[model samples]
Target: MSTTVTQQPQHSTLGECKRWLRVSLYTIFLLTGQCTATLLGRFYFDKGGKSKWIATSVQSAGFPILIPLLFYSSKSTNHDSSKIKRKRSVMFTLYLGFGLMMIAMDFLYSCGLSYLPLSTFALVCATQLAFNGVATYFLNSQKFTALTLNAIVVLTMSVILIALNTESEDSKDLPKEKLLIGFFCALAASATFALHHSLLQLYFVKVAETGAFSALVRLNFYPMFIATVGGVVGLLGSGDWRSMGKEMKEFEYGRVSYVMTLVWTAATWQIACIGMLGLIFEVSSLFSVVVGNLELTIAPILGVFVFHDKIYGVKIVAFLLAIWGFLSYIYQHYLDDRMANQDKSDDGLQVSKGEEQI
Candidate 1:
């Protein structure tokens, strides 16, 4: 008789709780990276040159590279063997639609910044929470609870207060049409962002069972491609093709040594940050929207000290209120999770008792 070998089951290197903690930390880091990149963009613009173009170019530079790296990393860990078999035409259409929406968002946002102050921009962009909520309700069938409504009101009020109290650097009056355009553009961008969020979620479910890397890469591939195209088109259309040439020549000479180094650095950070956001969104529930929008609250407070920006006591109070509201939201989520776990444990006990009776 031949002896047979039995392999012992190996314990997971990381526990589920530890994995969750890692994800939470990574999510926080992603948000911090985004905030840092935003600060870097502000610095790049302050250093002179075309602020808008510099911000765009630098942000674009790193994302194209980081997305692929992170995506491949995610892919390596995924165990799902299923293939996505959607027709090329359909997939291209989805990607193109999403890409164009994002492109429009970027274009409109940059144009808006040309008119509005940073404070105004931040306040307006905060409405993304509202847009995200609405989109989730319609697209994902997530129930709209009273807490969500209350949170929205609190956050909206906070943003309005912040906007009203924001100090302007220029005492001179801005053009009425430009201001209107800026406000509308910013709102449009927020709406588009909401759509982008939902679309990416659906895409994650459809094309990738495990969205660790493939999900991130697929999302960025079209958006970056479109953004690159938009940048090129904008550069050409503005008759500043020379600026494009100059940036490229600088990159060729030694991208790191170029004056656009800050731009490139910011871009890299942005890509990583966004990729992190996508990953978190894929894994978390609706509260992730709340957490993401809280970036508005975090960025401004730091900006006041870091960028010499100013915020009034009223706005600070409003931000605190918003923070309270978000905290309440998180507390509610914790309670729900606790109750759910309890129910699950009780069900297991009932099943065991039924089996004993049998």
Candidate 2:
């Protein structure tokens, strides 16, 4: 009996260690993949890549990388009958709907990246938390804690500060109209991203079970496949396909760099998506977005060095406010974790007392 008690604690500790290790790995993937992908994306535009469809296409065109993982996951979980039980037509519709949404979000983001400076774009993206809080309230039925509300307000202030800083050196060359377009497009993309996460969480709750890694692959794979196809159609329909050779030849870094930039952008975005999905599966959509927002901190700092993005006084303050808001959200999660552990400990104590009485 003593051995059993000792082994139970050790086993529980091991399981927790494994869970945290997984979360840490996922966080690393999310941070590195997203920051690198964004930088590469901005680099593409800076170096003469003009087709937004091409940019959007590359975002999901790397779905092929997920294929091998899908195959492995399928082989490992073939006996798991608790998979998606919906009709084929229904599943197709869901995939199509999500695919179209992904296309819209990607295109909007591409537009933002094309017109805005990378640092401003990253700061604008922080508004996703506010949009996400709203979506979570309506779709996921999540209540807002004080910390979350504070995060929403503080993040909004960060964006407002950016908006007021019109004399920013980054925007000196950009026409006001284009700046407005970039601002609104980035804002729309942020809201769409939030909606996507909430709806995905709802789908997971109502129709799908999140038990296997294969489930994560499928959730990403089909929608990305459709998005890739849509991107191709748009590229062709827009006649950008014809100019691809000219664009590459004129690229500042030469043809090889052009191709490699798009390729790596595609690869890194997929890596980031995998990490984002892993977090959503492991925790909640809100938690996933919080980790994603961490990129806001890293990307801008990198932008200063790579792109020579100006971090003037107002922008710096805005950046600090963004960090403050993110920390508030993190603290809330820390408190929740503490409460959960306390509950688990109480339950274990009750079980032990019952065992002793018996």
Candidate 2 per-residue C-alpha lDDT over 158-184 given as tens digits, one digit per residue, 9 for 90 to 100 = 756765663354553689999899999
**Residue 69 lDDT in candidate 2:** 90
| lDDT values for all models | 0.63, 0.81
lDDT of 1 by residue, 10-109 (tens): 1121343555565566567566767676666565445434545545545544555566565576667655333344355666787777667766777777
Q: Could you tell me how far off, in angstroms, the CA of residue 141 lies in candidate 1 after the best superposition? A: 1.6
The TM-score obtained by model 1 is 0.78
Return the number of clashes found in candidate 2: 0
Q: Which window of ten consecutive residues has the lowest lDDT sum in model 1?
A: 1-10
Instruction: Give the CA lDDT, 0 to 100, for residue 159 in model 2.
Output: 58
